[model samples]
Target: MPRLARPVPAVAAALSALALLVAGCGSNALAKQPPFPRSTIQANAADPSEKPITGSPTTGDPVDPAFAVDKLRLLDPCKLLDDDALKELGKPDDAVPGGFSRCSNFMKDKDGKDLSITVEVGQTVTSEIKKADKKIAGYRSYEQVLEGSACFVSVITQDEPGLAFTVQIGYKDGDGCVPGRKVAESVVALAKGKNASRTAAKGSVITVDPCALPSDAAVLEATDKSPRVYPYGLHNCSWVGDDAEMTLDFRGGFVPKDDKFDSKQTEIDLGGVKAYQVQTTTSFPSCTIKWVQLRGEDNDGEVVEVKSAGPKKAEFDRCAKAQSFAKALLPKLPRA
Candidate 1:
């Protein structure tokens, strides 16, 4: 499972409270919330193309490739949960961008209870899709409850077999799957119509595919041999070789500074941009390099991160490897 690289601040706070419930720390609060309900909806496994909705952008078209991964990278995930789409759910707060391909909307029900809805595009799905027992808005959908307070509803958007549009609902006061399924349907409907907004800024990292950033030779130099590639979501990619691994990640958040990760972090000059290098052996031998690629409003900005890791017994310096790869990769990134 791919974890969220950066969560919106408000959503993070909300999830933190829910995490306490999951940890069995809030029994008194848990008693006030309704029990998770059994789903009564039946599964529809029939081909959606067989019953195409009239005038639907994705139905009955021989080459309906609008939702392809490349196109999805350009569409804004924050726009998927617009007021018109989420009006039926509750009073929605402004949509906040979580990362390149993720956005979150926090809402309040009529009873003033909190609900969080997050939309993440281009998620890499594997065996998780096997649990998909329902189809929503002409797409295969999977619903799962998390810690009995949140629900995840993912719609398989690509037949290429790994991409999905996932909607997550955090509602501790009610059955989250019910709202989760409804939000998934709304997401599918809006996406099929091509109604989601697009990122307007030129040279934004969201337009760049992380998998295409580093050259094969560059990866080989870092990993010691031919490497296998793994793309995570739309903004992360990794190359694993026999003895080492390298990862590239693009995320949006406040600029990183020293003393942030509780490790030995040093500021280094990568070309002209100021970059931070953090080396840690908390788990294994690993080092990470990050630099702000574009400054956004306030303290938030776009960040380019590179990580290098190897076996603990390896004699090579991981920080040196991370810095070397970052220098080579930074020149290839799109500038603001």
Candidate 2:
């Protein structure tokens, strides 16, 4: 008993070193996991569904929240925001959403900036009711005053393959803020027709009144009587310009089914505008899932498809939006 095992100093030193190495790795293991199948906190926890019932600091905490925008996603979520990243700073509006609770999935540029800044404009003639998911559609924007400057950071969702904001990010000159959105709006206002920087969003599926026309159509109604422009999003549905009737796919994008699906456009003249209506049904089902069906009639799988006019078009993106909108619309439509 008096010996006290002092005979193995070398062994004791080796054991201590091994323990420190293990501890170091254990600390970072949570943050070091890959982002694909999506990392879950329950990986190490014994119970996957054992959610905390009360508000406690012991809730689902991430080893690392800023999981490099390239990896962490709200279409997926990373672990958690670091202690320093949470230091609330900037303007009153900068702290607008507080933690940007409505936002998920932080997507930034190469230099690390949030991009979810697209907002809806004008009043809707119809209710802002969701045609698809009942929840309001949008994301979060982060605003903060950094170094005496007003700055906003938003997390844009990857609704499609690329960025989701109608407004792009602007460069920082050590003063002022982003400029893409401003530039885009200006372009939209200046647009004669196809030249406008007017971008549209794909939203929940909603039925259109057979007697209704697009908002843009109302504008052209004062001018040409050939091609008509179909405005989308309630405010605008159809417009007549030269001798053509334009179908605004603004409410929906071109969703293709297969290569064999028709790639033609429906030409109509409203107020002589010379507009082309690219039907979603005319376009091939871009995705095997979310296939669009006839709005009312039991046309079965005989859904139509449509695509844009020119060569440079977003066929796939348009189809995706159509599919999503159709899926949302089917459940809400008056139903045949």
Candidate 3:
């Protein structure tokens, strides 16, 4: 028999190393292959015709249900608290829907002090909870003080870390966070699926587009030049000119509860409508005025604000100028 050829140890070691290198290269090459584009998959998933009959398809690893706030679209914050809950919490007698994902419930004490609950629905809560000041009910928690009266308790959903909501509760004489947490708990307990239906009545301020409030002539009269309109959101607009600036905002929800301007505000009558005019001397000379299209309700009306650098190159009063624009714009506003 041919002498058994003892393989060279060095050569054998080299071969083994080479095989390992080849295996690693194969894995890297597989990794470099492009993954299926998520956008394409999402598009297909979105179309009703593409759903598989037997199993649900997903884009990636399933999200934790605790962090999911999408169901908020189906909920109305105003409906979360029953009469018993409301009474137990001092009976917030009014509910104001701020938007699709927010609401405020409030009542006033004998002293004209407000007791209120405000709720906001949010997603991406997991990250927020990671930095929470406390933990409650197996959820990340935090608190905030609003205007020195209200306490807000924010809780991250345990099933879905990225989903969360806040309950803002306050009584002028009581600890805000304590009530806030209780309300938050109740809200969570009541967070079952319920259809949310909302509508803005015709000829209402809620239906008006703030950017379209000013006419060309009104813009010229107020700014002394052509107006450049910038819409900040569904209910806010701004106009800019050479030396003038004006903003139209929706302040219905906040104006009713705020007393900050009660001492300085003066009324400006526009036809049958009443508006509050306030002059500010801080920062720059400016005037702000609010008019009611809908009163006694939250998020109810339009606020027109005008600002200038100072009294210069002017033949008119700053507040008067603001008032003039508001008056001119009022008739054009939607009528209820």
Error of 2 at 126 (Å): 8.4
Q: Which whole-number lDDT from 0 to 100 does residue 24 have in model 1?
A: 25
Indicate the residue-level lDDT of 31 in model 2. Answer: 19
Candidate with the larger TM-score of 1 and 3: 1
- lDDT for position 248 in model 2: 27
The models' CA-based lDDT, in order, is 0.65, 0.23, 0.49
Which model scores highest in lDDT?
Answer: 1
| Per-residue lDDT of model 1, residues 195-287, tens digit only | 674654644687777777887778888898887676666677878777799988887555434325325678888878788888878546899
**For every candidate structure, what is the RMSD over all alpha carbons to the true structure, in angstroms?**
9.2, 24.8, 26.3
- By lDDT, the better pick of 1 and 3 is 1
Kindly provide the TM-score of model 1 when superposed on the true structure, using C-alpha atoms: 0.78
- Write the residue-wise lDDT of candidate 2 on 157-272 in tens digits: 22111121122122233332343334233322322123312221132222233113223233233223444333222212333333223222212222233412224644443232
The runs of at least 3 residues in candidate 2 whose Cα sits more than 4 Å from the true structure, single-residue gaps closed, are 1-181, 189-194, 197-210, 213-251, 254-336
Q: Name the lDDT value of residue 278 in candidate 1.
A: 81
Instruction: List residue ranges in candidate 1 displaced over 4 A.
Output: 1-64, 159-161, 256-263
Clashing pairs in 1: none
